[model samples]
Target: MSSTRFTDALTRLVDALPEPDDFPSTARNRELTARVGTWLGACFLLAFLTGVWSHLAQLPDPVLPLPTRPVWLYRVTQGVHVAAGTAAVPLLLVKLWSVFPQLFRRPPAVRRAQVLDAAERLSVLVLVSSASFQLVSGLANSAQWYPWSFSFRATHFAIGWVAMGALLVHVAVKLPVIRTAWLEPQGQPAQGTVSRRTVLGVTWAAAAVAVVTTAASGVPGVRRLSVLATRTGTGPGGIPVNKTAAAAGVARAAADPAFALVVAWGDTERRLSRADLEAMPQTTATLPIACVEGWSASGVWGGVRVADLVDLVGAPTGSAVLVESLQRVGASSRSRLPGNVAADREAILALTLAGEPLSLDHGYPCRVIAPNRPGALQTKWVSRLEVRP
Candidate 1:
């Protein structure tokens, strides 16, 4: 029968591929895979947690506000996020290569086992595809390039959840193998083309090289050394800008002499001009503007303390404030500052960056300079402050 012959040929094709049992089950292969996988898993966990924090912080009404005290919190987390993701490129390649031999492994013969095996393979495919997209897009974003039309944040965030979920499923499916491999006593690495030590040493060196090259954006001394470092150089006053005044369409209003910062509370309100703000006791704070795009710059900012501005309007001791920007559009044109950011003395409505008046590109007139907050949330060309909470 034609149908029976077709089934027989298909079965033959499946049997032709190497079985899983055919791959060398040496102590070295399992050990190497386990170690590399363990490191990769850790990187994913850190990137996910930090990413969630970033997402929540950017929300209009955050259920939980991130702390403002550490000052370098956002800077460190974002730096680590990029760094870990960068390191993953090489780690992933090595991991895939280590397991590539199993790709030829044949599927289960039993009906029940075949179904479970199919599911496991599907999970692995999802994990690999999502993770690959994340790394590619993340690196491309670092270079400020976009080849796709979709919203990077939304797409990446959704894929991140998918990737992590798939990763968990993959782990669950492989746990038995992982457990047995881990528990087995250390033994002489089975003879192979290369020693296990050599493979491990090369992998570690490759990852380290990748990290060091891309870390130039964060380390001043290595800036010249790291050509791959995406963010290098300054905007104005040696500080960087993610969105320029012209780009945000705030050039006209930002330069208008009639512009006054409107600060309001339930029953009290104050309109402070450039002079009024300058006349106030200016406090200085050093803060880094860390962007979600994986770039950052630091500068000395001097301006009215956030608490002092809140006090003028008679807001409660720890009232949350909504900051409005002169920019005409964009979701980040306005931002909400939780009580923690409002209460910090180091958090200021900055008029100047690095001793000079804020360059138009650097949020001219005034901008929020708070510790540990994302650069996008630091509303630029600040027009008004509403102490609603």
Candidate 2:
């Protein structure tokens, strides 16, 4: 058989499948569903674009490989991903409610034709199921819980591709009807349409309010806006006490090295200890420590500007600075230095928390604070610094 003939045959086979017309009341429900779906699609597209851009920007040099991207970019994009996914929850629910009745519609024909129709419907079901799971699991992961054994990030990424593929197929199949619907008004009763508008307006307003409230709650002037307070516990630093127990708590055995300010000139290295650092002029700033896990705290940090530190040590510009943690072993632990230190100017070896010595869990002896990065990148337990070209 010719290729054209085979293609025509397949087209005919699919065209013979039964059509189901049990679409729900085209009243207010349909209009609301359309609006909600449009909003969600727009949000998802924005989030997708931002995420792709951030990932591309943080790509490491081809010569070196890292398990994750640089800390600052990763923190920003991860927050964006979580926030966008979280907002999609109610939008999706409203969309689903409007189209749910279509699930039980009866077909126009029976036999093999009906089987193909059912298969098409099944594809939609799979898309909805997988997308729903992805959203819920993502939300849970943001809350710092992993109920399933599988990695949420990896699984979520995989399922997102499947869902997008299925969605594209679905839209292709429905292009004609969708275009018609787009061109024509839903013709819902005026009162019903008004009610839907009210509902949607309220929903969007509430969502905006929630986001602003949550953000303000983290700041010192507006911390009251957030319902949850920052959590405190014995963290990685294990300071204000014994260094041995702190290392034991996080399951590491590392010596607590004295704080040092170092400068390298060609082959020779010059070093200044903690007393030398304290002898320099100091500046303090109050900032909030916001964790990706949805908890935040405010602290007053007193430290020399990282630029000042470099200058005091007489290090050259564009040099790499390594910030190590005394509370953990190896560079991979919570003590690990940030991946992109040269790009940031505000990175500091912090010495005080809320105007006092650092707390045990808060990196007691000394910690590195890089603004706008996740808590994970903020290494606790200061030990060493290596300046390099």
Error of 2 at 11 (Å): 28
Query: Which lDDT value does model 2 have at 253?
Result: 26
State the lDDT of candidate 2 residue by residue for 41-151, as single tens digits.
665655555545433433322223232224345444554555566567767776776677666566648699788788888888987887688677766765557788996
**lDDT of each residue in 1-389, candidate 1, tens digit only:** 69999999999988787766676634337778887887888888787887877788687777777778688878878888888888888888888878876677677799999898788778888999998998998888878799999989889999999989998888887888778767883665666667666777888898888887885477667667667787565768787678788989989999999889999998688999999999999999999998887667788998999999999888876889999999868977999888878999898999998899998888889999899988889999999999986
RMSD of 1: 2.9
Best-fitting candidate, scored by TM-score: 1
lDDT of every predicted structure (CA atoms) = 0.84, 0.56
lDDT for model 1: 0.84
Worst lDDT 10-window in candidate 2 = 233-242
Report per-prediction Cα RMSD to one decimal.
Answer: 2.9, 8.7
Candidate 1 TM-score to native: 0.90
